[model samples]
Target: MANYERKIPILDCGHEYTRRVLHGKWKIRILLYIAEGINRPSELERHIPQATRRVLDAQLAELFKHGIIAKTIFDESVKHVEYYLTDLGNSLMPIVAMMGKWGNTHIDKLRKAINTSTALA
Candidate 1:
C-alpha cells in the first residue's frame, strides 16, 4: 500500500472553512451562476436544471448566512429579490477557477491512481 503524504497547510483553518462552505454538491455551481448574473431563483433553476427548487433555495440561504452571497429585495409594487456574490464571495472566484483547472487537469490521474490502489487491495 502506498502511504498518504501530508502536504503543507495553507492556514490552520482557512482551508477547512472554505471546504465547509464549498462542500455542498451544488454550492460552487450556484456561486458561479450567480457570478455570471443569474440572480433570481427562477434564473438559477434555469441555469442549473439538475438542481431542484427546494435544494437551490436552501443552498442560497446557507451561502447568504455565510456572507458569501447577499440578497437585495426591491420593495416595489411587485417585490423582487436578486442574489449577488458579496466581496467575500467574489474573492473566492479565483480560488474556484484554480480548483476547476486543477480538477480538469488531474482527475484522470486521480482516477487511475484510485483504480491502481483498488486493484492492489
Candidate 2:
C-alpha cells in the first residue's frame, strides 16, 4: 500500500467519514456485488475483471474492517470463503442505488466530462 499523509486532517463529518469508508476504486462495486449474492472471491474476480485480485482483496479487507461485510470460511476438502453484507452494509444499499441511478441519468454528460479530463491528463 502507498504510504502518505494528508496535510489537513479529515473533517469530523458524516459525509467525509462515508467517503473515507468507501474510498477505494472498486469498493462500492464490491459492496453492491456482494449484496447481489456474488459473494465468493472467485466470483467477484470474474465479475470485476478490470481489478487485480490483490486490489480486490485489499478493498474486501477494508470493507470487512469497517463492519460493512462479514466473511465466512468453510472448511471441507477445500477451503472456501464467502462475504455477505452486514446490517450496516444493507442500510447503505439505498444510497448506493441512488448514486447508480444518478450516474445512469447523467451518463452522457459524465462520460463527456470524463473523456475530456482523460484527454487533458
Candidate 3:
C-alpha cells in the first residue's frame, strides 16, 4: 500500500482581492484619480487618455459592481454623474500605497534578477 501525504491548504488572499480590483489599464488609474478628486467619467477619461471610452466604461461598471465605487446621478438642469469611492474602497488606500512603496523599493532588485534570469536563459 502507498502512503499519501496531505499538503496544507493555502490561505485565502485579501491582498489579492485588492490587486484584482486594480487589475487592467484604467482601473488603478481611475481609482487613484478618483482619490485625487477626479470624480466624473469624463474627467477619468481625460486623466487616462490612453484608455478607450469603451474600456473605461467597462472597468467602471466592474468597480461599481464590486462595491468599490458609488455612482451618483443628478436630476438637475443637465444630467450629471459622479463616481466616488465607498468606505470599503477608501479603506484599501493604505494597502495600495504600501504596495506601491514596496514595489518602488524592490524594483531595482527585481529588474536585476530579471536581467540575470534572462541572460541565463
Scored by CA lDDT, what does every candidate get?
0.92, 0.95, 0.86
Q: In candidate 2, how many clashes are counted?
A: 0
What does candidate 2's lDDT look like per residue over 3-39, in tens digits?
A: 8989899699999979988899999999989999999
The CA lDDT at 98 in model 2 is: 96
| Clashes within 3 Å, all models in order | 0, 0, 0
In the predicted model 3, the residue pairs found to clash are none
Question: What value does the lDDT take at residue 106 in candidate 3?
Answer: 100
lDDT, model 3, position 70 = 95
Off by over 4 Å in 2: 1-7
lDDT of 1 by residue, 1-121 (tens): 9997879745658778898889888999999899998899999899889999999999999999999999999999989889999999999999999999998899999889999999999
- What is the C-alpha local distance difference test score of candidate 3? 0.86
Clashing pairs in 1: none
Candidate maximizing TM-score? 2
Residues forming the 10-long window of minimal summed lDDT in candidate 3: 9-18
**TM-score of each prediction:** 0.77, 0.91, 0.74
